[model samples]
Target: MSHEEIIKTTQHWLEQAVIGLNLCPFAKAVFVKNQIRFVVSDAKHLDGFLDDLDRELVFLAQAPADEVDTTLLIHPTLFPDFEIFNDVQALADDIVAEHELEGILQVASFHPDFQFADTEPNDIGNYTNRAPFPILHLLREDSIAKAVEAFPNPDVIFERNIETLQKLGIAGWMALGLQASQK
Candidate 1:
């Protein structure tokens, strides 16, 4: 698929799955405020993708929070394997630490086949991190800290998300039209 199509699909998933299911309580705020940057990377190699990621991290760090609070660096062609994606995610996190952005920035990973360590492959909870393509969600640590502070019981977000997705089930999730992109 083309980059535009990938972005549209990713946006649709964000609307119908992430926000629609309330997986992320903070997502709607940034999304509605148009503070989320959706970047589609066309890099076919890992090195090129890492370069793009580096650029995005720098861009987000330098940009004003009001103008760009978060970024979804979507990679459509690279890291199709979830394991490889996870490896790259680790590298990205290392980059953040190396840049001394440990408290200033963070990276959240997502993939079409995202599965938790102990969960079954088809577990509904995995859907919480699933997206149309491999994505490194770059977020401002300060924003996350503030959001968590304002949110009640932020520590229970993972369990809450699991409960929410379990209630939704595979059938309900399929109804959202996200499964089509995975295939």
Candidate 2:
């Protein structure tokens, strides 16, 4: 698919699944303020993808939070399998530590198939992290601290998300149209 189509699909997933469902309470603000950066990776090889990732990590680390609070490095076709995506995610995390941005930045991940350990592949809870494609969500730790400070009981977010997804169920999730991009 073309990059525009890829971006549009990713944006649709962000709007319909992430924002519309309120999966992330902090997301609405950044999204509304246009502080979220969406970078589509067209790398056909792992080295090229890693290079792209490196650039994004540095850019996010240097950029002001008000101007770019977070980034979603989306790879629509590179990671066709969840396992490969998960492996790449580990490398992405390692890059953060290697860069000495351990305390300043971190990498979170999302995929069309984001199964948690001990959970079935089709578990409703997995929908919480399901996105249109493989996405490395680069975030600033300070932003997380501030958001958590302002929000109540941030520790309950995981449980809350599971409950929210369960309540929504597969039917509701399908209605959101995010599953259309599923591999």
Candidate 3:
């Protein structure tokens, strides 16, 4: 897909799923403030992707918190298989540590097929993390800490998300039009 379409689709998922479903309660604030950065990776290979990862890590680290609270580095075609994408997630973490961002910054991943461990492929709970494409979510630790503190019972967020998706069911999620993300 074209860059514009890729970005638009990601935004659509954010609107229809993340924000609409209240998957991540903290997301809406930054999203409305335009603090979420959507960057489509232009890497040609895994090695190149690592370079792109390094660049984004540095960018997020140096940028002011109010200007860019988070970043979604979307790579449309590099990781079609969830396993490969999952493995690369470890490397992403290593990069953050290498840059000495272990506590200050972190990386979370989301993909069309983001299956949680021990869950069936079609489990509704996995939908909590599913996104339109392979996404490396760069988050600020401070922001997370602050958000968690302000939110009531932050520990129950995961259980709440599972319950929410379970209530929505797979069919309901499909109705939301996120199946296109599986591409």
Candidate 4:
């Protein structure tokens, strides 16, 4: 699917969360454009960010796609830290192992130390100053199974996530953990 399609598809998924989260229309658009994976730090403000998608989020669609390499470059912003990402990645690996995936589902997240000033690697995706965190670009999927395998158990991850949002309020939620930020 094209980038627009991906954004739209992701929005559909977010819609389900809106019932409880009450996300604003614009925030929904921004989150999808930025490719912020499903997460809510402050259930209240989760919609706020959705209402105003940062310009950085919009560029995610324009990112170049890889033809031969199927690496999924995940920006660090997606998770709280490397440990969380590693757990998620391990979960993905488990899914792949269980499903017997073909092709590759390589992963990459944000490296706080990696600077844009450094020489660009041909294989790595570009980083945006606006969305300074990290991002995940699923390079390729031989089948739907491979693509589906990339995600972790949302119920498990978001269970505490929702509570955190409720307790922390919008500002608090944003500051607390790896809540989804569209920008």
Clashing pairs counted in every model: 0, 0, 0, 16
Model 3: CA > 4 A from native: 180-183
lDDT of 4 at 101: 39
Question: In model 1, what are the clashing residue pairs, if there are any?
Answer: none
What is the lDDT ranking, best to worst?
A: 3, 1, 2, 4
Instruction: Give the per-residue lDDT of model 1 (tens digit) for 1-183.
Output: 988898899999999988898889899999999999999998878888988988999999999999999999998868788988999999999989877889999999999999889877787788899988899999999999989998988888888888988888888888889783252
Model 3: per-residue Cα lDDT over 93-176, one tens digit each: 999999999999999999888888998888888888899899999999999999999998888889999999889887888798
- Model 1 — TM-score against the truth? 0.95
Q: Each model's TM-score, in the order given?
A: 0.95, 0.95, 0.96, 0.25
What TM-score does model 4 achieve against the real structure?
Answer: 0.25
lDDT per residue for candidate 2 within 1-183, as digits (tens), equals 888888899889889878888788889889889999999998989999999999999999999999999999999888878889999999999999888999999999999888888988888888889888899999999999999999988888888888888898888888878683243
Candidate 2 structure, TM-score to reference: 0.95
The C-alpha lDDT values of all candidates are 0.89, 0.89, 0.91, 0.33
Which parts of model 2 are misplaced by more than 4 Å? 180-183
Ten-residue segment with the worst summed lDDT in candidate 3?
Answer: 174-183
Say which prediction, candidate 1 or candidate 4, comes out ahead on TM-score.
1
